[model samples]
Structures are given as structure tokens and as C-alpha cells.
Target chain A: MAKKNAWWLWAAAILTYLFLYLPLVIVVVFSFNDSRLNAEWVGFTLDWYRKLFHNEKMLTAAGNSLMIGVVSSLASTVLGTLAGIALHKYKLRFLPFLVLTPIAIPELLMGVSLVIFFVIVNQLLGILELGLITIILSHIAFCVGFVAIVVRARMQGMDESLVEAARDLGATPFQAFRLVTLPVIMPGIIAGALMAFTLSIDDFVITFFTAGVGAATLPLEIYSMIKIAVTPEVNAVSSLLMLLTLVLIVIASRVSPSALRANG
Target chain B: MTLQQRIGKWVLSWPPLVYMVLFFLVPTLIMVVAAFRYPGDYGGLAPMYSVEDGKVVWDLTLENFQRLTEDALYFDLFIKSAGYALATTLACILMAYPLAWLIARSPKRYRDLMLLLVILPFWSNFLIRIYAWMIILGPQSAFTRAVNWLVTGLGFEPIQLLFTPFAVIVGMVYVHLPFMVLPLYANLEKHDMALLDAAQDLGANAWQRFWRVTWPLSLPGVFAGSALVFIPALGMFAIPDILGGTDSIMIGNLIKQQILDTRDWPFGSVLSIMLTGGVLLIAALGAAVARGGRKRG
Candidate 1:
């Protein structure tokens, strides 16, 4: 009876996997569809990929996304690591609530509120307006919460006595952290940074509000393209974006499974 | 602690704390304030004070809240969004549970691979993922063609699948299934099977063992997965915007229009606050259930 039940579950599992991967696979496969229309596959060709490479706007948007992803992830990693370390080591009472608040709230609300704040600030203080800087700032704001949570989860599982041993051996506080604590938590930090990078690069709604006319990320550009029509070029671009994300997830899984697990 | 150590800790925390305050907390507070206030003559949020007779006059009002109640549209959208979210959560739980259970029962080496298969697409661009569904469910796509072929002799017209409520629900389940599965798998994987074996030895059948033991143990995962799915699904704009028709408008679409099209900042803020309040209520209820489950366990 157990074996019979297990067979049905295995069949359901296979169907579920198919359901998850089917859309993604179709997107990838159609990127090389020779016909411009997506009605039926005419033949396989690489013209769409070539067109994507030559499309200046698409390339520029991809570059902007990369630059913003790099800057936001780096900044978020630094602040998030520091916050995670401080919260873990010092046990700041209100820090967890403060850090987790962004995670708990809906992303649409977060995006709207941040846009409102930026508009207010731009009016009050003449220094800033919606642009690449605002987009990066918004990305950093949301990405930091995930990074801090993942790093802190890693720190909670760490052996505390390693840092103590380093301190007892006449190492300075900074030295203890550098030599012992840093290496132990480096996987989490790296995982967090990569996760930040992935979230920033793939963000659409927040970047849509924060990114004004001058700056458009890949997702924003894709949204416009998708709004106009469904083209093979869009499929090609999506396949490439999915490939980049796949690479990041592979590296993240290698670093720490718990980081991805902590995300949920 | 010494003063120097205290100062050092403060210094260490200042970056993230200050950044969050300036960005997240302050903006959220502004949203709350904006919800209570009114929009200016043009497009921005109205200032709390206006200069009248060379003096700052208070201009606060509860008009936005009042309007929210008076307009049945927002209330209807909220209820519709909740209904969609609830349906999506139920579908996800049904779809994810079997997959998660299979992965849990699979051999150890392939288990991680199966789990990764579930979560891999979650890292991709969310908008693009929804767009992928458009192609799959489009009238011209193979899925529709196959469905139409299967029912050829029935003398029924081909179904329009895209830009429909069913399509929106499908998109929601596709996007959120991994979220549902991951937490469920995490909970199910750590189960102590010895209890199951003991129950079986005592003549409890599979159904009894599962209901009395497995069901109670997995309540936390169910709660976690439902919270994750339901909250995001409620506030999702992209899925509905891409896959839903005008008849399927949800609160998120209304909020998006308020911000982008109508430029009604106060109304947008009001909707934002209401959505946030609803999500918090759900989370608090989930926590209560979790606490009750723990006591029972």
C-alpha cells in the first residue's frame, strides 16, 4: 500500500516539475524560433540572439541593470553584514524589528512609499530627483533586509567560542573578527551579496517607480517591450536574464543552501 | 559595557540603521501621514499647513479615509484581491504539498536536486516569468492548440485563455508555488519517522497516522507557506496587469493607477496603508495559530 501511494506521488511530482519548467523552457526554446511570430515554430535559428546583441537600447538597459545591481548589492552587503553582525553580537533589542519591517511589508507598498518620499525630498531638498541614483537607493533599501536576515541566520548557527578563542589568544577585537569570524560567516555574506545582486537586477516594480525617464533597468525595458508586443527579441532577452539568474542561484546554492532557505 | 565598546557598537550599526530610517521607516511614516492628508491642487501630497493671513493654518482632514469608505470600488477590489489570494493559496498548497512530500520521501541524494528544481525559477525576473505565461496560454500557443484538439468533436468554440481571471490565478500559482513548496519541504524533511513507525506498529493505518501525527506536525509549514503566498498574491500587480482583463481588476491595479495614472498620492497612500494593515492582520492570525499548534504538539 505504501509503495502504491508512493508511485502516485512520484507521478504528481513529475507533473509538478513539468508545470514549473514548461514555461521557462518554452521561452528559451522560442528565443531561437526562426519565425518572428510565436504561433508555431518554423525552424531553429540564432538570428534573434544576434538581433538582441545589436539592439543598442537592450544592451544599454542590460548594462545599466548590471551597474545598478553591482553598486546596490555591494552597498547592501556592507550595511547588511554590519547590521547582521551588530545584531548577532551585540543583540540590539529593537534592531530585529527594524530590519524585518521591510521584509514583512508588501513590496508594492514599499515601492510606492519610497517613491513618495523621494518626490517629497526632491521638492524640499534640491539635491536629488528620480534617476539612476534614486533607483539604486531604492534597490539598496529593499535588498539590505534580505541580506541581513540571511547573514544573521548564518551567524545564529555559528560557533561563538571561535571568536572567543581568537580573543583569548591575544588577538585584537578586529583581528578576532577578521581571522576567525569573517571566514566562518563569509559564505553567508557571499550568499547574501549574490542574493542582493539577483534581487536588484531582477526588480521591476520598485525600479519602475524610482527609475525616472533617464534610467531604465532590464525589467523596465522588458515591460515596455512586452507592453508593445510579444516579440522574439523579448524572448531572447528573457532567456538571457533567466540564464544569468540561474548562474547566480547555482553559485548561491554552492555557497549555502540555508541562504536560499532563509529567503522564504 | 564600557563606553568605548558601546560607541563602537553604535558606530557599527549606524550605517544600516540610519539607511533604513531614512529610506524605509521614514517613507512608511510619510505614507501613513499622506493617507490622512489630501492631495495638493496639482499632483503631489498636500502639505499639512497652508499660509493664510501670513500664518500657517492647519489643513489636516480625514477625507481620504472617508472617501475610501464611500467608494464601493476600492472595497470591492479589496474583497476581490482577497478572494484571488485565497484561491491561489489553496491551489498552491494542493500543488506544492505532493511535490514537497515526494521530495521529502525521495532518496537523500536526489532530494536537494528536486528542491533546487522548485526554487530555481524564483530567482528569475518576476515580470518576465509572468510574460512567459502569456506566451504559453496565448491563443496561438501549443497549449491552447492542444486543448482545442483534445475537444475537437465537442462542437465548442476554442477557449480564450489569456487575459482572464483563470490566467491570473495560474500566473499566481506558478510564481508562488516554489514559495509554498520550500517551507513545506523544510518542515517535512526534518520529520522523525520513528513516530510513524511506532504508530503503524500499534495498528494505526496510514490515514489515521497521517491525520493524528503528520497533519499536526506540518501546520507550521502550512502556515508559513500560506502567509508567504497569500500576502504577496494580495498585493501583486504585475501578474494581474499582464494576465487579467478589465473585469479582473484587483486592489493592486487600483493602487498602481492611483500612483501612476491618476496621480492621486493620498488615495494611493490610503490604499497602501489598508493593504499593509490587512497583511499584518493575516500574519498576526497566523502567529496565533502557530502558537496554538506548538502547545498542542
Candidate 2:
């Protein structure tokens, strides 16, 4: 009876894993199918990839996504690292609430609120239009929480004695931080930066509200395409994006495994 | 605190503090105020004050909130969204339990790898995940054809699978299963094997040991996972928009239309505030229950 129960558990677990992976596998497999329709598995071909390269809109959107990702990640990394250290070191009341609330709220709420806020600000000050700049700012607003979470977890696991000893050995605060603390958390910072970049590139809902016109990221572009019709080109681009994410995860795990766990 | 220590604290905390206030807190406050303000003739909010007959007149009303109560359509939509979220959470629990338990019971060396496998798909682009479902549930896909064939063989009319509530629910579960699995795995990994052993020694069967021990012990994990899944699933617009038909609109879709299509910012803000209130109430209730459970335990 026990053996039978174990077998049932194993079978259920395996089926769940299949449910998770089967859709993704079909997507990848269908990306290379020669037929335009996604129903049947046709002979293998890379025409969709070729068409994607030639498509001006997709390329421009990809460029925009990369540019926005770089700027947002860099800006959020600095602020998030500072917030992380402060959260771990000090007993501040309001900072944690401000930093973490964005992570807890629904993205739609944030997106719509930002849209209202941007319009009001534009009306009052005659600045801050809804474009790439607004989208980047929104990305940073959300990404900071995730980066701070990873960095704070790293700070929690650090040896406090090392920083204290450096201070006691006639090192100034700046010197101790620069020499001791910074090096120790370097992996966490790098991991946080990568995570921020991935998030910025992949953000859709917030970007949808904030991106008024003339600025289309990869996700916004993909959404328009999906809305119009299904095509193998979508599968082609998705496969490539999955490849990019897998590579980033590999590097992040190599740099700091705990960062992944902290996110989970 | 010393002056230097105070200055150090200021240096580290002030940047994020000011940024979050400007970007996050202020925007949320503005949305709250927007809910009461009049909609602009064009798209945005109307002017707060207008000079009428040499006097300042404030243009604010409770019409948006009134609109919500005036019609049962919005109320029905909210209930439908909540129902979908609840169903998604329940389905996630059924699927996540065995997988989470399997990972927890695996040998220590393989646990990390197993957990990573579960999270890997989630890290992919969100739209891509939804699109994957579009393929699987598409009318032309083999899965749909197979279902239709079975239906016809049973003497029932063939049915549409794509762009239905079922498709929307499947997408929600696929997207959120990891949220359930992770917390449950974290909780189950810490269970004491000796308790199970003791139950067995006392003539308890495997089913009894699980029902009497594991189920009760994992309630906190269940609650945590449910909250994580329920809140996001409730607010999800993309899945329903892409996979659901015209009749399957949720509150998120309605909110999107009021803001983007109709240019009714005031009404959009009202809907958003309601959603935000619902989320907060749920969070507070969950926290209270967890605390109450802890006291009793």
C-alpha cells in the first residue's frame, strides 16, 4: 500500500512537470516549423528567423527594449544597493514600507496610477511626457524592490565582524566600506543588476500604460503582434528571448546562487 | 546617535526615500484624488479650480463612486474576477501539492536543482508564456482537435476551446503554479520526519498520518501561496484579453477600457482604488489570521 501511494505521488509530480514544460516545448518546436500555421509540425526551416531579422518594427522595438533595460537597471542598481544597506544596517521605519510596497501591489494599479500621475504632472509643469523616459522611470520604480530584496538578503548573510574589525583597525567609514563591504557584496550587486535588466526588458503592463506613442519595447511590440494574429515569428522571437533569459540566469547563479533563491 | 552616524544614515537612506516618494507614493496619492475629480473634456482630469464670475469653483464630485453602486454590471464583473482567481488558486494547490511534496522528500542533493527547474519557466517573458497557451489552445492545434473528436464521438456537439473562460483559467494556473509550489516546498522541507515515524508506530496508516499531521501543519503555506496567487490572478488583464472571448471580460479589462479607450480617468481611478482596497483588505485579513493561528498554536 505504501509503495502504491509512493507511485501515485511520483506519477502526479511527473504529470505536473509535463504540464509546465509541454507548452514551452511546443512553442520552441513550432518556431522552426516550415508551415505558417501553428497546428502541424512541418519540416524544419529558419525562414521565420530570417523574416524577423528583416522586420524593421521588431528590430526597432528590440533596440528600444535594450536601451531602456540598460538605463533603468543602472539607475535602480545604485538606489537599490543603498536602500538594501540601509534596510539591513539601520532601524528605519518608513523606508522599508516605501521600498517594498511597490512589490506587493498589483502591476495594473501601479501602471494606471502612474498614467494619472504623469498626465497631471505634464499639465501642471509642462514636462514629463509619456515616452521612453516615463517607461524607464516606471521600470526603475518596480525593479528597485527586487534588487533591494536580493542585496538585503546578501547583507543578512555577511559577517558583521569583518566590517567592525575594519572600523576598529583605524579605517575610516568610507575606507572600511570601500575595502571590506563592497567587495563582499559585489556578487549580489551584479546579480541584482542583471535581475533588474531582465525585469525592465520584460515589463509589459506598466510600459503599456506609460508608453503613450513613438516608443515600443519588445514586449509592447510582441503584444501588438499577438493581438493582430498568431505567427511563427512570435515563436521565433520568444525562443530567442528564452535563450537570453537562460544565459542571464546561468551567469547570475554562477555569481550568486542565493540571489535566485531570495527571489523565489 | 552620534552626528556622524546620523549623517551616515541620511546618506544611505535619503536617495531611495526621495525617489520612492516622488515616483510611487505621490502617484498613488494622485490616483486617490483623481478618483473624485471630474474627467477632462478630452482625456485626462479636469482643472481642479476654475474662475467663474470672479470666484474660484472646485470641480469635484462623487459621481465615479456613485456610478459603481448605480449598476450591477461592475459588481458582477468584480465577483467574476474574484471567482476566477479563487478557482485558479484551488487548481494550483491540487497540482502544486504533489510536486512540492516530491521536492521536499527528495534527497538533499537534488532539492536545489528540482526547485530551480520549477522556477525556470517563470523567468521567461510573461507574454511569451501567454502566447504559448495561444498555440496550445488554438483551434488548429492537435489538443483542441483531439478534444473535439472525443466530444463528437460521445454524441455531443463540438465546442470552442480557445477564447473561453477555461483557456483563461488554464493560463492563470500555468503562470502561477510556481508561486504555490515555492512556499509549500519551503514549508514542507522543514517537517520533522520523526513525527511521521511516531504516527506509523502508533498504528496510523499513511493516509491518516498525512491527513492528521501534514495537512494541518501546511495550512500556513497554503494560505501564503493562496495570497500570492490570488492577488495577481485577480488583477491579470493580459491572459483574459488574449485568451478569453468578448463575453469573458473581467474588471481589469473594464478598467483598461475606461482609461485607454474611453478616456475616463476619473472612473478609471475609482476602479483602481476599489481594486487596491480589495487587495489591502485581503492582506490585512490574511495577516490577522496568521497571527491568530500562531497564538492558538
Candidate 3:
């Protein structure tokens, strides 16, 4: 009887998701449609696709975002995983919780302070370019915390004996980690890396302050578009961006085989 | 130390530690120092670490604090930001509660799909998502036209849903609804159905059962959701800027204006510092409330 009553519950859940995603669905559908207005059911067309293909700035921004997201995620994942492993392995003064608190640091403070640092550092270094290097470094700063926490959670349940077994088998310390430890924790690492990638791709506040004009990201371009008219072209681009994100998220949640099965 | 442990200690800790100290901690300390130092002290916002005329010339003074006390404009801005944040959080809760309950009660196979929808928008740029609201709310926009059509069809006046405090709240609620829902779902999924059943057995009605059992258990989720919504909502400038359309200033806007437009770093620092403190205070209060409820339980 209670199970039967869950019909109303099903209706509600279905409607809620529809409300959340229907706009995005509309945008995506219209990206392929001939009409300018999403309110109408326009005939399907690839002019928007053709138009999207011809836009050099948009393509360039996409390339830049991919490059930035990859580099930043790689940096943060390496640093954060190292940090997480260190926190668990070493007897640090504070617990993993304290080390993990930058996740809670208000984004505004972090954004503003990092902006100030880049200015000072750029002034001091003189040769420092504000495009790729600064943007990646700043993203790593924001991302390292979340990655550390996620990896640390994975490390908690992991058996300590895995590494010990490798050592007894005559593997060097690095080899043991490569053979025994890395494979076991690679899922957490990949998950953290993916999260870092998405975050970097979505990041604006920190990048806004740190990134130079030449390195203006898709988010920055979108920010300007909004301030302006936010035309149909931006809508088209947003739909594509959303699609890219969904594909990646679906891939990420599948939790690839390389995670547990990869060579440590 | 064991060779394995030695490598772990240095390899894992030092890189992250040094990066955080150099980038995050040092910069935060500098901003803190910047806040305390008086106006016109840092050689006109340039680097000048020197002494002048027998008075230790440093960029550290009480002028910013003094200005803040006299600054009624800023005082009003802070108040409005807090007021808007409170309203937005309440709106998010009102929308999230039933949605979360329904989702929690749904079939297991469908739950993940529904949850993924909520997170999909979140994965999009926060700014662009807010900008979507702007496009919808702009004059002659699809959302506006729909409202007009609905109102005329229903024989009623067109509702004023855009470019006001109402629009801002609506946008904020839309943007932040998932934060409220996710935490609530996390709690609701774990909630014991038997508690409500026991209440029903005790002759309590549905409302009474909810008040006594369901409400009490779900409080941790509610607190977490409210805190999540409220703290960031208070600091939001972008949403209010785009959706509020005009004459809707928040603390974040004020801070941005102070830094970028007004060039009053000391005053901006003070406001930013106040915002940081506000977040901390609310977080502390949330923890205390949760703690108190547990104690009473």
C-alpha cells in the first residue's frame, strides 16, 4: 500500500527534474534549429552548426579552456594527491581536516588575494606572462583542497598492508608505490582530477583577476556577452558547452577500469 | 624513519605546503595587513616601505575604520545584502523541501537520473547560469512573454516578476535550489520511516507526526542547506547585478566597486573582511544550533 502511494512521489520527482533541465534541453535543441527564438518549434537546421564552426574566437576559447583545464587539473591532482598521501602517511601537527580547510575559504577572499599575489609576483618576476602560467597556477590553488579531501577519503579505507607487501617483494619505495599503492587509489585520483578539470573549466572569479587579455576564457567571453545583449550565438555556445560537461560527467561517474586495475 | 615513510613525508607534504604558504597564506596575511593600515599610507597604493619626517611612514592607519563608521552608504549596503540573503535562503528551503521529499520517496532506478539533472546546471559556469536568468527576464524575453500570455489568458494583470527584488530572489532561489535539495536528500534518504509510523500509531495526525518526528530529524539538513544558501547569497553581486536589473546593490557589488571603481582599497578591505567574518559567524551559529539539537535529543 505504501509502495503504491509512491506514485505521487514519482510524479513530483519527474516534474522537478523537468523544470530543472527543460530550459537546457530547449537551448540544446534550438542550437540545431533554424529559428532564433527557443519558444517556437523551428525546423531542424545546421546553420548554427556551420556558424559555430566558422567562429574562430569561440574555437580558440574552447582550445584555451581545454588546455587550461588539463594543465590545471594535472598540477592540482599531482599536488593534492601528494598532499593527501603525505597527510595520511606522516604524523602532521594538524589532522587531515585542518589541512583540508581551504575548501571552506570564501571564494571571494581566495580570488582577491590570488589576484594581488599575481600582481606582485608579476612585478617581481618581470618576465612572467599572465596567460597560461598564472591561470593554471591560480586554478591549482583553488582546486588542490577539494582534490586532497576526496583522495584523503579514499585513502582512509585503503589497507596499509598493500605497500608493505610490495616492499617485502623487493620493490623499491617508488616501485612499490607504482606497483602496489598507486593502482589501488587511482580511482580517487581520477575522480579528483576530473573534478579539478570541471572546476577549472567553470572558474571565472579567480581567472578574471589573474588571466590576461590574450588568455580570456570562454567564461570571460560569456561574461562580456551577458553584459551586452546575450544573443542567440552565446546561447548556441552555451548549449555546446553544457553538452561537453554532461558527457564528461557521465564518463567520470562510470569510474573507469584504469582506476583499480591500473599499474600502481 | 622507514624508507617508505621518509619518501612519503617529504614528497607528499612539502610541495603543497610551500605552494599554499607562498600563494594563499602569504596573500591573505598581506590583505589582513592592508586592511589594518591607514589610508594614504602605502605611498598612494604603490610600494613604499620607508620612513618620513621622523614619523614611521607605514600604510597602516585607522582611517579605514573611521570611514566605515561614517559611511552610511556602506552600512545600508551590508544590511540590504543580509536581508536579501535571508529571503533567498528561505525561498530555497520552501522550494527544496517538497522536491527533496518527493525525490527521496521515488523509485531507486529514477533517483540518480533526477539528481544528475540538478547537478548538471551546477557544473555550468555560475556566472553564465545567472546570465541565463537575465536573458529570460530581460524585456521582451521568452519568460516575460510567457507570463504576459498566461496573465492575459487567465484574465489577470501581468505579474511583475522581473528586474526587481522579486527577480533577484527568484534567480537566487533557482540558482541555489540544488544546494538545499542535495543536503536535504542526503538527510531524507537516511530518515527512518518507522519513526513516522510510530507517531501514526500513537494517534498523531500527518501534520503532528511531521512536527514531532520528521521535522526534528531533518533539521541537520535544513541547517546545512540554509547555511550553504545564505553565506554565499550574502556575498553575491553577479546575480543581483544581472537579475535585480537596477537599483539592487549587494555587499559584493559594494566591495567590487570599492576596489575596481572607487579605488578605496582600505575601505574595500574592511568590507571584504566584514563579509569573511559574517560567513564565519553564521557557520559557527549553524554548528551551535546543530550541536544544541543533538544535546537536547
DockQ of each: 0.67, 0.68, 0.42
How do the residues A1-264 of candidate 2 rate in per-residue lDDT, one tens digit apiece? 112238889999999989999999988999999999999987999999999999999999999999999999999999999999999999999999999999887899999999888977887899988999999999999999888988998899899999999999999888988999999988889999999999999999899999998899999999999999999999999999999999999899998888777785
User: How do the residues B64-159 of candidate 3 rate in per-residue lDDT, one tens digit apiece?
Assistant: 777878969778888888999999998787778877887687778776766666766777767657766665666556778888899889999877
- Pitting candidate 1 against candidate 2, the one with the higher DockQ is 2
TM-scores of all models?
0.96, 0.98, 0.90
* Candidates 1 and 3 compared by lDDT, better number: 1
Residue B102 in model 1: shift from native, Å? 1.2
Candidate 1: Cα lDDT at A191:
92
lDDT of 3: 0.75
- lDDT score for candidate 2 against the true structure: 0.92
> Could you tell which candidate, 1 or 2, scores higher by TM-score?
2
- Give the Å error, residue B110, model 1: 2.1
Give the distance in Å from residue B297's predicted Cα in candidate 2 to where it truly belongs: 2.1
